[model samples]
Target chain A: MNASEEYEIMIGNHAAAYACKGAKVQVVAAYPITPQSPVVEKISYFIESGELNARMVRVESEQSALVACVAASATGVRTYTATSSHGLMLMYEILCWAAGNRLPIVMNIATRAVGAPWSVWTDHQDAFTVRDTGWLQMFCEDNQEIYDTNLQAFRIAEDPCVYVPTLVSYDGYILSHTFMPVRLEPQSRIDDFIPPLKHHLNLGDMNVVKGVCPVTTPHVVKREEGTAPGYYEFRYSLQRAMEHSIEKVVEVHDLFAEKFGRSYGNGIYKAYKMEDADIVIFAVGSVASESRLVIDKLRAKGIKIGLISLKLFRPFPAKHLREVFKDIKTVVVFDRDVGYGYEGILFTELKSALYQLKNRPFIKGYIVGLGGRDVKADDLINGVLRTIELEKKNEYVEQTEFIGLKLDELDFLKKGGKVENGR
Target chain B: MTEEKDYQKILASVQKPVEGEAGKTGSWSTIKPKINLDKCIVAKMEKNVCHFCWLYCPEPIITRTIPPRILYDYCKGCGICVEVCPHKAIEMVEESEL
Candidate 1:
């Protein structure tokens, strides 16, 4: 296999599809959703063209899609699925069940905002909602990272240390639809990286049906004992594996970099220009890309500002985040989604992580994009600037603020007057 | 032949309940379905069409005799029988420890 290959322009969804192919996934079950549909489409094309030999189960719903994948995985086949916002929401219960049973199914989730007010745009809310469902969640910054992360997710999920399903997420429209130059790894190398799956239980044996049993009385003594290893022990082991994943993630990234010639940082958080900064801007996904431009502009103006891009949202990365921002005096968190009647979800988690520190920075939460609203570089710059001003005054902003709200439209408030209603 | 023996052993291990053990509802302390006699179509008419609970119970905990009765000891509290009963005869009641 030739190592020096020309860069191919591929969207994040296509990159994920290629990674699935590279992983040698034997079974794929998917239902179409915006931005995520192309992934399954490409894989189906691959299957049709004889490039990949896999069973493509066309399922009715996302729940059935995951159920089919779980059943496939239990039969010792490498299985994968992809879904986004509402589709991911539909698979919530099954996601928990799959992980609880220690199935190593890989799912690529294109991050999109959940609807009710119905907008098909990008946000982290969908992925963040199911953060605790025992799946290893890895967020990518770009198309290449999305490609590499999906490959790594399969290896990590199937590892005996971590036999839980993993979701490799890239922002819906921002990364999924946007085409970028990505290096495709040779199938031979990926084959080496991720081995053929060895299932904990095989359902194909005629004598005994492993893991499946008739529903018995709750008072059944053996059933009580069976619940422990099936539920608690499996969950505990998955948690331990996720906690241990920090090092494994780094190792995989390093090896991938060495083999494929590209690697993102090993830690949960990726810091940029943070070495000697006093104030830092924290964001994820495409907003973080905008934040980097804002940081560069601020740095040019002789302002001490840095950016922390969170790559892994789950396992929360609380300890690493504390260490990264330990020296900084003020931190600004830009959130794309807002938890109703509360601060942004990312801000709340960050605050809880940083609460125990003896001398913590004044972490300001700024709710920004929602429903596909574009966040410009200037908006990020202004948010950081506000944090810097607060640092100068040595006064902490107790309230979470909206970064770009149209205040002039409010009839109750006069021009240039603070609205009586406080958020 | 070996596989056939294993199947036979597994099937043998699954205990078959003895006669008169079917309708004894006293053992169910965790979850039990109650029949509202007035609302029960079968019980009201003294007919057997309302054997829906007995039919729908995945565990087959409810047995149909002259009238269907729940064998509470074996019920796993899935409540499928309660939800599927056409006459609304079966109401799943949470078992309380005295």
Candidate 2:
């Protein structure tokens, strides 16, 4: 309840809500979903208690929730929503509308494992599913970041130069439900930092006469004559927005730190003991926080290893990583979500980002922590050791080594072959 | 009289563009829809009534008057009006057949 610069223990969902409240959002449209329910619940409380002056819309489904935000955002009002797992998946259709219409709708996804057999726990799969959906995706390390990222997300989303919908994500259950000390920024300062959201295609404007979010009419950019813009132009513009927002994300992160005295790697990626190190571990979210202790433990054992935690995933900081990887000899990329048929999503992105750069590290991909599996120091140490061992033998490292995976747990490897889903 | 026009720069109209890039779809027609005047609802049998074809036309090309006329120039004839017509009044015929 302390609106000033005061530290208090709060769960990640509440911290996100506190940041949402601080942003002075005009419309909050959300549905109840696991790990994401408390966020809207807290927002509803804020609305009921007169703490937040916004419409708290409780929609029956996540699709309607996002579509409502899209409509509200189109009319020049700041809109926010939070969802996770199946809710995010249910929102898949309208997500494109939010981005294609170029509405600066800020959302938070408590990253959760996608279900087939129904498990409600933390994993990157849900958020990773929407990487190509034209939104700036960022992952947070802890509850503090969940708050900070939400605050930055509005600025990043609403920037006239960007105008791309943004999603700030944190690990479900691990950070979403876990209580931790969060420093609340002063309301006055937050007001000063994030300016009011403005729609580029303001529905209130007299000039905007036609309906938008148009259907398919040849996806080519019609530069010839008698047309507004083509699908290709908008698509290219979204990409341009993403590329431009990289600098904006870093800039606003540093600006937030300057004002509130807190920033995580200036809002793109944070490094832990990266200086004077020959090897590094690159990962995202809670793994980054735990890697700090892992780095400490490894450095104690004379391993010149460091950790680089990726905060922004969408505008994937390719050039920054390329520059960093050029200086290292080896990097272990641990992704909590698998890219399924290929490799880990983050690992694939990291490897390709640094693939062409001269003197790039011998990057090794390790898939870990699927379905909220725990990643202890031993799991991380073993992954690192495997990477170093691969480098020693001059062996071609496999694309993905499933960390902490017990083969015996597989249905096929079980004593009784129990076919699932009646297949 | 002396003004030179850049066709690419000039807008097709004064109003805002529609979803199909304000496409002048009037030229998309190859075969046009011909209404059977005898069986037409508004024109022949039921005057000032039953504009089902007009309501069901995918394109806003059918206007209900004394007889609902199909704006064949813009109508990419898909037989939607024929399918929806209450009196079997509308029919799609080849431009050459006309």
Candidate 3:
């Protein structure tokens, strides 16, 4: 441990706030939501106490919060905000706007389940809902990872090769409310790690009057004066930025490890005990962290199993997943959220990623812990055992099944032991 | 890396401040607003006085000066200046009449 490093017991929300403070974010625009409020609240306190010289703009709603961050980030300043399920839903329009404009605004998502049954619990639905919005998404396993990922998010988002906004998400109550010891590097080292943001567009400059995200033709418009790229070209460039960010993610992770002595795999996903395993358990966030215990238990029983905890979700990291899962025989995905009409979102996406493989593994997905339900190690073990049994019996396994559900007790739907769920 | 550097040079949609972003709306119209210097308030006063046509012009093509002139490049023939000119100095004249 470095002499300049300080270890303190803090919740994931406070860790995110300290990350924002350490990065010296210039503007914080946010509105309050459960599980995400403490992050912005602590940032506001930092601003109030003059520990961080930054502007705190408390807007009416999450939409305006992101909008203000977009405008502030366009001015070449590092900006931040926090939101949850409904709040993220409110900011969906501006989320695309931020990405389309290539603004490097960082936001922490305390991942919560979207409501219809009015659930205020931890889930992946909130993060998965806008997976195609073109933002770089990272999921954290614990408070320490929450802190490290948040700091790394700023550098990754503002990298010249990738001027895309970033979302650092941790499970709502699991990480946000739970306290853990996080090692924080000194302010000078942090400053050296993440310098002031030098964004592409600076709307704050008065000398240069500029128009941003204006409507353009579907194809390039050429005239006697000059040539202007069309909307398609702009979108292609954004996609390229997303693709190129994978390298920057690894580069920044290595640099951070060199300076702060903390690393998470190659910054895309972290693997545990995959050297000789034929079957791998795939999960994200707290569920993946919890599965480490399950791995230990299963390993003791002479099972050839491992765990692949995904850190980066967006841009899918298809290449890396494909590389890691090439020799594997089976992959069992545990999701805290379902894709509603389809199976688990990660399960479908992982299948899509491995579609091109010549000898693909048999993959099964199980939905577990929706709406803050307690995800027990026994349940995870049972899920893994069920998958292994299906493999041994040579039976076609179901695509998605709910884990730890009290289906027998429920009187709503019981027709021959099969409930007609989603598509 | 060189390829990446090349992509970084020309990013997504950001345009410098330019006039006629929608491209010279004057060409879209058959008529344009014409101002008579003889009756214009600013023109007659010979000093920077009331230029209602310049203030109310939606396209804001009218110049704020002595004998205020309408910039025909992007006028769009809106006739807002004609209705706004208190002294009846502005009129939307057809191109054939001009």
Candidate 4:
């Protein structure tokens, strides 16, 4: 271990908080919510003990928390906040404001299931809700990954070339409350890695009077002999930034690896034992971590199977996925959340991504572990084996199938006569 | 080589603070307020006194001086200054009549 590296058993939430401290975040505004509460609590502790020089604004609501971060970020200071589930829903409106303003705010999300029946468990539904908010989205597998990705998130978000907000998410309770050994890099090295925020626009500067994110017209207009772009152009710029941030993400990841001696493959998707495999398992977050076990089990049984753990979700990494899936014959995707009326969210998007490939492999998707349902290794293994069986028989498998669903013996559905979409 | 489209050049929705950003808002109105020097407090008194019109103008085009002059270039002709005039010296006249 490097002399500057300190190893300790840390929870994912604490690890994320340490990353914010190491990055020298100037402002943290957050409301405590289940799973995501500890992250802000730890940050508050660090600020109170004087270990980190920052302001911890105790906000009453998650909406106000994110809004406070937005206001802080506008002044060209590094800002951070954390939330989950209903808290994320509350901050939905301001999420667009932060991205549209290009404020480069970094938010960590402990992925949790949204309510109705009220579940406080691990799921991807909360983070997926804001996938289109022009923010870069990343899901980390383990606690170490949670810490490492949080540091990288700030660098990625604040890059002047890609001045967009970012969401660093991990499975709630699964990673948030779980403890694991993580190596914390020294403050000096982290400082060298992520320098203070620099941007083309600084709302903090009083000398230069400027208006930020004003109500723009539908078309470009002339103001005091100067041309200003309209709302459409502003939104287009945000879209363009997201499209172009893919490169910056890889570059930053590579740079971080070069400096810290650690990196996720291509900074987008990490492929495991896929060099000679024909069938591969695709998943993200904790599900992807579980697929590693499935890969080992399948390989031991003389099956040529591998796994691809997705890290970057937004900007989708379609190009990298296409490159990796080129030689594979079949891909089985496991999702912790469903797209409701449609199939698994990742499954549909992956299909669209590979639609252009002339020799695209047959792909299938499985919905697993919704609302923190226990996804057993046996179930994942069975799903993959079933997929292989279907592939060999050239059987047309359903777009989405369920794993770990115990409704087979349940009599509730049986009592409801003439269900239109009964399984 | 064809020129590539640069989104960065657009710089999103941010812009330097400038006057008349909404275009000459004065054109939006049909009536313009005219101040009568005969009954104007500041104009008749010839001293720096109460220029309520200048303070009450929404667009705030009325300048606080010896006789409070309105900068008509960007004023929306809201007639707010006429309402706030204590001396009843300001009146709104139709732009077409002028």
Candidate 5:
């Protein structure tokens, strides 16, 4: 379907493809990985069917796929790519290069579980691992937000003040596979919204002298006046850029709503049932959307509970969250994934963000629905109840709890197991 | 903070990948190549035509003079001229020795 059509029923991957097409991305180089493969497949279909005018490079590996996009973007072309967990891991090297070079490359990630035993389920572990790589990280909760955010990502990333690469991540099967209604904006409106990409380095002309992070560095000084900055200064610029990015994100989000009549809580977060509420549940991705149902159910039974869905993950939206949670008594964070040797990654980030505030709430972390396990409304309520019960005590509540786990079976293994060590 | 008597050369821009304009890259070479003109190829071009050393040098400073003189200012001492000399007319001496 053309971008002129507004409403249609499509899966999340197809919605992503529609956004890339509407943005008129010039180059798409992606490797196939499950859950995320459909996004690349749909884009390739658009290219092959003569509907979307773009070059689709089917690379051999994820590293090559991102490098190809980096190369195309170096010449000032808008580029796109998509990948799942292990595929995202494989691209770690070039991913850092793309962001470090400030290429404004837009990529979609179908967030999935990383493998040791190899399970293809939705999780936030993959995205959390690369949060510091200098790309704008956005977590979308539904198909419509996925479609809209992908469209808006081009404007936000290509903004001269914030020329950092942006990653749009949605849940693996729950959102990527499920059919949902999405509204596609008109092509002219999208073109009006996001203009042609302008390169900071302007490598389009060869005579200007260009190389991607040239070698032989440590004090091998170029007598030329514009030698590269010290590594520390280069990284410091990115940190400053990240600090300035939240303003651009809000501007884009507000402009998008003004043009098409939609709102996403000023592009940082969406708070539900927060009015006159004492406690709130915080989550990201599909879990955030799922919590809405639980919030509605709890509010009806005289429960002063609210829900806060994180729309942007990176640059962590600290100020916005600090303002929202100032009055709340407790915040129950469901991570759906764990950070080794610590609590949930999002939970850790939340506590750290809220630490400097005047009236900080008692925040609790729970690892739930890992590896695609069902996290129903009832399961979420149990976690919330545990937090409430712990609130009335003078004792310490555990920092992290793994919800819906078969602890008895694991306990049996711990109590009565043979210790065979190749003797 | 002690940079050899507090010398700091401030840069005007962040990394411009200057091509042939990066002042005299020959300072990058550790081994200075000394060409022996008695057996040089381009020096004996009147006797026979062989200038492989000039053709194979990766730097722009190598020229085809009577003895195919290597410009030490930009030679970078990369020994390619020594290795590519058909007549075995060039030898790489350590820069300290030179």
Candidate 6:
């Protein structure tokens, strides 16, 4: 077999681990959480067997794990870490700090439902909650995309125009634990693709330590000199870096496709069979894989249906989404988590993105799979079909609906009614 | 050894201030610390004390004395001595006024 030939694999976690190793990540900071534990475990074994020369730092908390990586990256080392759900939440405050200070660290997040009833199941809520934390967020559709996108994430995040952290998320328990065929890129090729990191600003150097603040003073003149262009200047520069990442993401994706044989689609949004469809479904994560199968089945029966899988969520890709959904009459958004008082968070953002456009689709937000509940292809098909039906009747539901809810055990409550189970 | 000699030469060049501005004259208009004998705690008591102003100036702007005074031309107005002086003997008077 040729070196370019694909080597199929069975699990997303294994594929992610292989990609990290293939990228020659120098340091691995591992803290175990459900569904994300296997990613670090596989890397640890590889390190012990001398397959990789990575240092695995066993940290006490997710915060310290990220801090350790930040410290290591500041020294101009390639760093990698993985976390899920509560662990991702714990690393929230430092996530902004890392990006603000311009550290290039790559992290893998296994998308799990945040707790109330406590579940280790699949959902995008955990990653979505930190969407505004200044990290480049990418959702993977399958095992191959999971493996290849992780490599691309490093290149994109570390690029000079976009020196921010990145998080590649795969659905917990669904794509993460499930086995699938994934092609591996040669280690040498990946090494050539991602060069060793060169940091522009590193701490502890004599110039940096002495030049940062020569002397501490409480004088107004000295204070103004020290903090000129002040706090807002720092935050504004970070925002500009994130906005600039939109172009860098496409450039790196194209470069990676040229070097390797695989391609992660273009234009920020990937449309499947949406050319002439009157109704389209917008979703992300492993659920998009299921939506694809449903779209294929619906298309065979002569129904005009399609699906738009959101790949990059943080930059939101609003302009690209508007162009894609321009002609469609209705769009049904399947969200894996609820925003409590509002509809699905993605649905709210999508609506706000399309609000000012003269020609826009009527969007319906559906909250599904709250506690790792499985969202089958049939469930998605039914939701899209109902959305089409509502459009045909010229009737729309202003309130969001929870699909696939088991209502046998719970009683319905009115606006002014006391629940029987209440204390 | 060669590098050390080069650095010392650079340091020696900076040590000599421009001529015609020598000793309590010329730009002796530049405020040099003036010790007040009456109000100074150490100068009045004739003791080796009151070095707070000397120790606190960020730029080494305060000249060490029984009660220290400031060299204003080089002082960047950090006001460390003004805040640190226990007897409030030091004031950051304007360089132009001095």
Which one is best on TM-score?
3
TM-score of chain A of 6: 0.91
* Cα lDDT of model 3 by residue, B1-98, tens digit: 46555456556566653457678877889998877888887877899888888788766677788889877878788788888778998888888776
Please report the candidate that would top DockQ against the real structure.
4
For candidate 2, the per-residue lDDT at A406 reads 77
Candidate 4 per-residue lDDT over residues A227-251, each given as its tens digit:
6678898888888888889998999
lDDT of 5 at A170: 95
Off by over 4 Å in 4: A1-5, A210-214, A409-423, B1-5, B15-98
- Lowest summed lDDT over 10 consecutive residues: which window, candidate 3 chain B? B1-10
Which lDDT tens digits does candidate 2 get at residues B1-98? 43432321221112333324446575676777788888886886657799888788776678868777776556777778888887887778888775
Please report, as a residue range, the 10-residue window in candidate 6 chain A with the lowest summed lDDT: A212-221
Point out the higher-scoring one by lDDT: 2 or 4: 4
**Ranking by lDDT, best first?**
3, 4, 5, 2, 1, 6
Per-residue lDDT tens digits for candidate 3, residues A1-423, read 654356899999999999999999999999999989999899999999999999999799999999999888888889999999999999999999999888889999999999987988999999999899989999999898989998999999998999889999999989999988998878998989997777788776756644432347787766655677787877888888899889999999999989888999889999999999999999999899999999999999999899999999987899999999999998999998888888999999999999989989988899999989889999999999998888787687555689989867754466655444532
Residue pairs in clash, model 5: A227-B15, A228-B15
lDDT of 1 by residue, B16-97 (tens): 3333334544554566677777787777778867587777776666777556776656666777887997878678676762
Worst 10 residues of 2 chain A by lDDT: A211-220
Q: What is the DockQ of each candidate?
A: 0.04, 0.09, 0.27, 0.28, 0.09, 0.03
Clashes of 2: 0
True contacts kept of each: 0.00, 0.07, 0.39, 0.50, 0.07, 0.00
TM-score leaderboard ranking: 3, 4, 5, 2, 1, 6
Q: Residue A33 CA error for candidate 1 (Å)?
A: 0.8
- Candidate 2 Cα misplacement greater than 4 A, ranges: A1-5, A205-207, A210-216, A219-226, A408-423, B1-98
Error of 3 at A73 (Å): 0.9
Estimated TM-score per prediction? 0.77, 0.80, 0.85, 0.83, 0.81, 0.76
- The C-alpha stretches of model 6 lying farther than 4 A from their native spots are A2-5, A204-206, A213-228, A409-423, B1-98
Output the lDDT of residue A350, model 4. Answer: 88
- Deviation in Å, model 3, residue A107 alpha carbon: 0.8
Model 1 lDDT, residue A297, Cα: 97
What local lDDT score does residue B44 receive in model 2, on the 0 to 100 scale? 67
Model 2 TM-score relative to the real fold: 0.80
**Candidate 5 docking classification:** incorrect
